[model samples]
Target: MTANAADKSLQAEVNALPWFHQIDFGNGVLSPGWIKKSKVERVSRTLFDPLNVTGKTVLDIGCWDGAYSVEATRRGARRVLATDHFAWSEQCWGDRRSFELTRQHLAPSIEVMDIDVPNLSTTTVGTHDIVLFLGVFYHLRHPFETLERVAAMATECLVLETHLMRLPFTTEPHMRFYPNDELHNDHTNWWSPNRACVEAMLRDVGFKRITMKHPDYRRRRGIFHAWR
Candidate 1:
């Protein structure tokens, strides 16, 4: 087949799926994903540094489209594991095609698992130096318990990003429950915890040092880097 034909075929396959992460395929052919958020620019530089993953084992929970999984591997991580079940399964607006394609096209050596958050443990997925728990906290039914499970497998650090429920003058940790799609018209979204709530919860879950930063306050998206 000609190069143009191969590109057309790849484009047809990419356009057919629901994509959450924008992945770059070579020859200037990029996946036409819905999310324009540059995980490399916005996420890698500010919230958490990908350069820090050099020679470390990394795990990315809810690794939609394997963006960070590929990034971690590119930054020289010893081993990279990506996991997801809800978005990859038939219950959501996404599938594993994007991740699989991205992995195949970019970082083929990274491992993947179709596992849920509650099932994460040292024994199940083994421990890692860095664990990324981004965009999955609010969607979970058991938030605190889920963090504890995530922490159990972290040997060095855990970086988490989630929707923050900002309540001014509230020093104590608190969470707002979303019943019947009160937040975004998505039934999967269950809770939005304030920044204080997330930091406190991370400390409670055995992370000795916790740092919180907000990429966009108006968007209510906060990032946390917790160290063991």
Candidate 2:
């Protein structure tokens, strides 16, 4: 087959996957998954899709279900490491069963590791071409410090996604909800951060070439693409 024909075939196969159908975004409607619908995926496809990843390394931090890791491997990453704190009991939409299901589905191309975030070290995870921090930062108490550690393990790029508070707001703008407080303790809950605070934190950690983009659909959240 010609290269165009091969490309079309691959695209068709990817589109036919179950994940390409729709995501169960919690409330219903079965919207398309972020990879199929969000700006982050579009941006990633534009920048990195052409690169050959047959022997490259990728690390996915807070890889809740290994979805991104699976995609990385499918795109030709030789090895993809998916790590998470595995404290799903503390998730805002807490569901341990769904996490396991995701793990099972991504078993072939991804390696899942359960580790404590603060204690992450080179001994635990070595360096990689890309390190993804999708939707993990706001959940941490020391977001900047954690990014520093993650940077040490990333040789090229770090892709991050998190909730950002609007500008002209103080830390006070961030509120604490006690909805799941009784179950997981106060520390294991959610945090909403302001964009300025997040940018300042990243700059202080020595991230360069920072590019921020709001998701096409979920304008409330943002994606930060940076290099060390």
Candidate 3:
């Protein structure tokens, strides 16, 4: 096949599925994803720039389209596992095709699991040196409990990226509950916790050192690194 024909075929396959993360598949073809490329690149830098995943094991929870998982492998992680359930099931509008295609064209060596947040544990998933919990905390109904589970599987560091709420006027940790599609008109969103709340929760979960930084896109959305 000619190069142009290969590019067209790749583009057609990518267009067949819905995507959440914009992934560049080389050959001048990029997936038509809802998340912008700039935003994803910015977030990726924030998530991956500071840390060295060389020869490390990584677990990316809620890896909707295998964006971070593939990147982790590219960044030198020896073993990277991309796991999700809702995103790959009929429970929601999305399925695993986009991720499957992306991983097929990008990094096939990376591992995958059809696991959900509640099922994640040290026993079920085993301990990884780095665990990525990006854009998933707020969507979960049980943030604290889920964090505990994620912490258990993260033997060295856990990088969490989530929607944040600013609860002004008090130093005490607080979280804003969204009973419905109150945030961004997405019903899947459940809670947005403040920075203080997140830090406190990390401490409670056994992280010794914690640091939080705001991303460039949103006003309060933060990416936190908790070290065990």
Q: What does candidate 2's lDDT look like per residue over 96-132, in tens digits? A: 3444544454446677677768877667988888878
Better of 2 and 3 by lDDT: 3
Candidates, ranked, TM-score = 3, 1, 2
Per-candidate TM-scores read: 0.93, 0.65, 0.97
Best by TM-score: 3
- How much lDDT does each candidate structure score? 0.85, 0.62, 0.90
Off by over 4 Å in 1: 37-40, 216-219
What C-alpha lDDT, on a 0 to 100 scale, does residue 44 get in candidate 1?
Answer: 61
* Model 2 lDDT-worst window of ten: 20-29
Q: List the residue pairs that clash in candidate 1.
A: none
Residue-level lDDT of model 1, residues 150-183, one tens digit each, is 8888889999989989799979989999888888
RMSD of candidate 2 to true structure, Å: 8.2
| Strongest candidate by lDDT | 3
Output the TM-score of candidate 2. Answer: 0.65
Clashing pairs in 3: none
Q: How many residue pairs clash in each candidate?
A: 0, 1, 0
How accurate locally is residue 100 in candidate 2, as Cα lDDT from 0 to 100?
Answer: 50
